[model samples]
Target: MAEKPRLYYFNGRGRMESIRWLLAAAGVEFEEVFLETREQYLKLLEDGFLLFEQVPLVEIDGMKLTQTRAILSYLAAKYKLYGKDLKETALIDMYTDGTMDLIFLIAMLYFKPPEQREKETELVVEKAKSRYFSVFEKILKNHGQDFLVGNKFSWADIQLLEVILMVEELSATALSKFPLLQAFKARISNIPTIKKFLQPGSQRKPQPDDHYVATVKKVLLM
Candidate 1:
């Protein structure tokens, strides 16, 4: 007998968006469970086989998988969307890790208090985005129209989209400075698979839970 399919989820957190994109890209069947509050999230951990730990987890036939990038790799390879060879796989893994760096910065911006935000942001903007995005430019130039390794769809390309959307949310001008990056984002936005998933009403259950939206609004208002 065939085993039952597993449940995929994000804890109302943006960290899982890229993994969702990967699953959607490969036309996989999965459920996106978004928990609204910390209480709800914690409750989820205790209510089922899900242990108290983190969000953005996947439960397969009762097996729990954690860590965003690991989940992405599992889905990508399991679905044959990873890449053609080990070299290509290496590239996919490289950018997937890089995308996490981008995400960690965004996550920091969320809980960072206003008093020290200036100093904290300066470190991220100057040290992180400023540093890596330049390398991103050269890679796109050298690699081709595709963002990471070559001119084909890969996990790396999808990995960049949510990060782009996140950065675009934070500062459009800063995001716009990398014209190619913006253009690349737009191109990926129009990918047939993604376009289908992004359809207005087709998004079921809950929308991408922005962990930072309300927090940022508070910071700006104060």
Candidate 2:
């Protein structure tokens, strides 16, 4: 049997969460090595595991992969979740890239001072609804398909689904105006692999809280 891919990162979501979601959507099992202290992170850098001196690394198929996009692309294409054609792949890329914008925006909230967080969250939520979610809502409405690209499940769908839930965590009514997206969420969540990951006791991590933020700050020396 092939060994499961092993992930290296702080215990929190960060960029690795998408990788975990994609792997789960692909029905692949994996392992994680969480960095609990600054020493562990520095040790990996000293060992040359982090090519860019940053994390979200993975060991898969005998290669140590760095960069979140590179790792996700490799897993997506390998698992046949990338799409059926170059055009479809391009569409997937466009959608995935857009989601990354929102992902990073929300991620920065964890580092914000408590006073700034509420206001920043409002901005993030507004940007998500106006800039990001609206675009996806239009796509789903026009395409009238179950999946994001080519009417088939792809990495883009997985990414959008993940981001949709992330935004919902911030605003419960995030999808209220986007009926198609609400349906899209329900549909995607029903997929067997994704459904399993959504259940408790799976590899999926929870939203970052005070402890997670502090631990990550210490680990990365931020």
Candidate 3:
């Protein structure tokens, strides 16, 4: 028997979601350690459990990994969710990086002060939807395939779906114009394991304004 991999993040999905979806999709059983409080996260930070003082940490194969993309890529390769060849892998990386960039912008909106959030939200949404979302739509159109790379489901598509959901959460109108991207979301969500994960009462939680993000902001103020 193999050791069950352990994932450390806040109780909410956040950056760890792509990993969670990949783990579920790959049928890999893993342990989730939720840091529900600032004290818990600070303790881990003091104890040197986090490499970059961030969450979404993973312990697998006796290695402690940080960074969302790095963790997702490692799991994808380990569980055969990665591309079939070097070229495909490179394209996957490109798409994954693009998703991460969008994720970062959304995170900025979430962390922005309430007073500035309205204006920030408008600017971020306009820029992101036009630039990032349009680029993604073009990619899907160009590939003319169900998946981002090699016409097969890969970590890239999974991450892309996650980002698309994030955009929708932030703006609430992201998918209205991007029919292909909307279809992509449906395709990924229909995967058996992912569908199971999406069921009501599943471990996944709703996005933004969650307790975890609130606690972190309060702690930062203290």
RMSD of each candidate?
5.3, 0.8, 2.2
User: What would the per-residue lDDT of candidate 1 be over residues 1-222, giving only the tens digit for each residue?
Assistant: 434335444343456666667777776656665554456555666766454465566775456777766777788888777778988888878877887887777666655667786677666665545776776767887766764765787778776776666665555666656777867877888988877777775432233334445532332342
Candidate 1 off by > 4 Å: 1-11, 36-48, 117-123, 202-222
Residues forming the 10-long window of minimal summed lDDT in candidate 2: 213-222
Q: What are the models' TM-scores?
A: 0.75, 0.98, 0.88
Arrange candidates by lDDT, descending. 2, 3, 1
Candidate number that wins on TM-score, 2 or 3: 2
* Clash pairs (backbone) in predicted model 3: none
Clashing pairs in 1: none
Q: Largest lDDT belongs to which candidate?
A: 2
* Prediction 1 global C-alpha lDDT: 0.65
Clash counts for the predictions, in order: 0, 0, 0
